[model samples]
Target chain A: MNLPPLVQTFVLHFGEMGSRWGINRTVGQIYALLYLSKEPLNAEDIVERIGVSRSNVSMGLKELQAWNLVRLQHKPGDRRDYFATPDDIWQIVRTLVEERKKREIDPTMTLLREVLMQEPASAEERHAQERMREMHDLFELLTGWYADVQRLDTERLVQLLTLGAKVQKILEMKDRLFLVPGSKKSRRDDAKDK
Target chain B: MNLPPLVQTFVLHFGEMGSRWGINRTVGQIYALLYLSKEPLNAEDIVERIGVSRSNVSMGLKELQAWNLVRLQHKPGDRRDYFATPDDIWQIVRTLVEERKKREIDPTMTLLREVLMQEPASAEERHAQERMREMHDLFELLTGWYADVQRLDTERLVQLLTLGAKVQKILEMKDRLFLVPGSKKSRRDDAKDK
Candidate 1:
């Protein structure tokens, strides 16, 4: 499948971004193609469209599958595997956040636990350890809040995301109800704004 | 120099996360070291500390420098090039956002423009092109907002971040500001809330 110069450019750019984001360049480009595509794409179609090796496309699909960013589809009478993106961008964003938390945040929390058991040899070491503890606690609270948010219906999320800039004001007013521990206040200087 | 176990744990976890965030594992680990370390480190110290090849450290440092996440500091009477991270996490976050916008968003915008210029061969193709236009426009708005947010002082930015979830709410109401094209009220189900 020959791609228009414009679509090809996006594919290429995502490929480069892929490496920066943790996915390989090929995976990034592949995703870009999928995102822009109006229809579900099969692996072979992706292979031809992007001009990469079949095996590479296969590998890329597998990785995308692992990330939960790709949806598998089946068409009647079709033996080949097919994939599509969730229709909602908000859903995509939410999934991205959840997957990142799993792959990135949760593991870091586990590492922090291991560090907490170590012996501190000096006053400074103890102070450093305390800082580490604070960071760990904060992250734990953050991870919990993320999980809570994820469980909310999609409508609630869009309600939250659209909040955009005013989110600070509500927090300042204590918004009364949304004030969970980690959710309570920011450690940054803006906390003074409230 | 011996690292306390907590810092060491963070280093290892960040190294793992590097692959996920689009950075190399070693590069992530090196940055983790720099972030946690109180002193600037030379390439040799990084290589020795991380047990990576000196050349790899050099390459990673070069990339970090390009991202503006790492800085060079020369010690008195020391000929070696040493590097360190910004003391503020928000600074690091802001820099990351800026770099990602430049490297990822800017190029994608270029591609979207190219796609818009292409002549659609069929009505179906036209429909797909229309969707692409919407996606492109949304990205353009998002990138512009990021640029605006970047210009805000650290204190203001913190205020925005500290507002956390509420910021998302305000962003939802942004369309009320004017008769902007895509900025028009979203038909999304959650559009009416806060």
Candidate 2:
């Protein structure tokens, strides 16, 4: 169960980065190993590769499953449980975004809304409420946009992303062509559209 | 230096949420206090209100400054430093995104790129490299989009956000009117744009 040097480096780095991403080192390492694994990996495989306690591996796998970042499978002839990451990376990204929004963003939004419901008893409370309202609006808008984009097919999303800064142009064009009526544009501008 | 119940609730919730967001509780509490404060708060005020040690408050303030979530200010004839969050919530959002990208995303991208450069010594390494490439490409596209959006003026950004799912309509309209040639649409459709 020895990992190759490259795998080891990648896993170790991910393990370090995991804390900053809000997961523990072992969870990150386990996810990295499963993600890079050519075949489904069993708990024994993870235990040997990561050198963590059996219970620790069990807990890490559970956390990953909860995050929807890992899936449990069984080998045709094997009795033990196996784990693997989804083959599609885009799905993985979507799952990460969804889970994080659920865990981190949603609660804050809820709290802000609750706080906003309270009557301001003082000037300080009023100012704080104003700030909270601003935050609530921003989060709501951003999350709403994310939800819209999340509905897009992966290919269309990729196309949109590949357009990158060109999207600003599309936004501009939408403003110019549709917002203004009968404004004459050069043929070059027409060609630049979309 | 007792915090009102409302502020206490917000601060405590943020402290609880902080670890999940990859910051320590003290730092989260400190930032929450500063963010809601009507005037700049010195370290002593923070320590008293949050009920943490002076050293902990000092460390948390330092961490918040590093994250660009807090700024230092000075009162006339006062040598002690005071801290406050930016008045504009949008600016705070921009700063948060920028700092998180620097601390978390950028290094991971750099590591993934480095790993991609190495020659895969085996099939296993090759599979790992492939996964790494997918991840690297995803991060690159996302960061690139963020960079483009970051250049937008706050008003433009807010307008774009407020558009939310309507943006998809603009995208579709662009395809219809611009991508397809000589397609006639009603003026009502034109008004619906942007």
Candidate 3:
């Protein structure tokens, strides 16, 4: 089956962007095709639409499944496996964030922790450990926040996103109303009260 | 100068992860070295420490500077250039986010917008366009939120991040106390009120 010109353009663009995001071009193209497809498509359909080998489509599908970006389905009468992206865009975004955190952030955090545990043998080693500590702390803060936000319902998450810069106003209000002047302990106590 | 084993372990690990983050191994290693170094390093020092060619170190430094990941400094009496990562980790994080957005996210967003402008030629094309629209909307929401948060002072940002799951409670409070019941429009209006 031939893809429409518009689909073709998007597929090509995504294919090019895939390398920059660590996936191969074929996997990106296959995901794009699956995402835009109105119905679940088999490997053969993907190969025909994407102009790749059957094996390549199979491999790409496998990788997408591993990333939790695509879902496998079976037709009522057909025995061949079919695939499609989640219908909800927010779910797709959530999957992408979670998978990336697992693959990219989690391992680095582990390495930083392990490196930080070792005794610094020199001033240079001490500085490197300090840098690693900073990185580890940043990653912990980010990933922990993401994990918390990930639990929110789509409606609530959208509310937060749409607020955008208004959140800064909210943060200022939080600081002014919650914290006692000149005491970190009061801030901690206020956070607990909330 | 030879790097300590502890620093070497981190440099090597970062080098491996670098390819996944869209940079080559040498560039990742060079950045890691500069980030962990106690003082500014010159090209010769980097080349010797990273065990890469002088030309490769020069090119990697060029790339790092382009990403705003490394700073170029000159010794008062010496002609040779020196490089170092920013002392503040938040600054580095901000640069990484902005640069990646510029390179990876912005172009895809522009392409999605342009593609959305074109009239769909068929039912399949229409479905593809819908998917693109969803993706574009998600990207807009995310990048806009990021830009807003980027403007925040580091202390405030840290407070927000450390709040983690507690943010959900805050959001719920905002919704109940601030927004009029049963209307998305009212919630948006309330945001504008502040």
Off by over 4 Å in 1: A51-55, A123-194, B1-6, B53-55, B148-194
Q: Is candidate 1 or candidate 3 better by TM-score?
A: 3
Q: Which residue pairs show backbone clashes in model 2? A: none
Model 3, B1-194: lDDT tens digits are 36898899889988999988989999999999999998999999998898989999989999998999999999999999999999999999999999999999999999999999999989989989999999999999999899899998887788777887687667666666676776886556445442
Best by DockQ: 3
Whole-model Cα lDDT per candidate? 0.72, 0.86, 0.87
Q: What tens digits encode model 2's per-residue C-alpha lDDT throughout A1-194?
A: 36998899899998999999989999999999999998999999999999999999999999999999998999889899999999999999999999999989999998998888999888988888887788888888899888988998886677666665666677777766665444564343454455
lDDT of 2 at B125: 96
Worst 10 residues of 1 chain A by lDDT: A171-180
Q: TM-score (0 to 1) of chain B, per candidate?
A: 0.83, 0.90, 0.91
Model 3 RMSD in angstroms: 3.4
Task: For model 2, report DockQ.
Answer: 0.40
- Name the top lDDT candidate: 3
Candidate that beats the other on DockQ, 1 or 2, i.e. the better one: 2
* Interface RMSD in angstroms for candidate 1: 4.8
Instruction: Please state the error at residue A186 of candidate 1 in Å.
Output: 15
DockQ for model 3 equals 0.68
Worst 10-residue stretch by lDDT in candidate 2 chain A?
A180-189
lDDT for residue B6 in candidate 3, whole number 0-100: 88
Q: How would you order the candidates by lDDT, starting with the best?
A: 3, 2, 1
Ranking by TM-score: 3, 2, 1
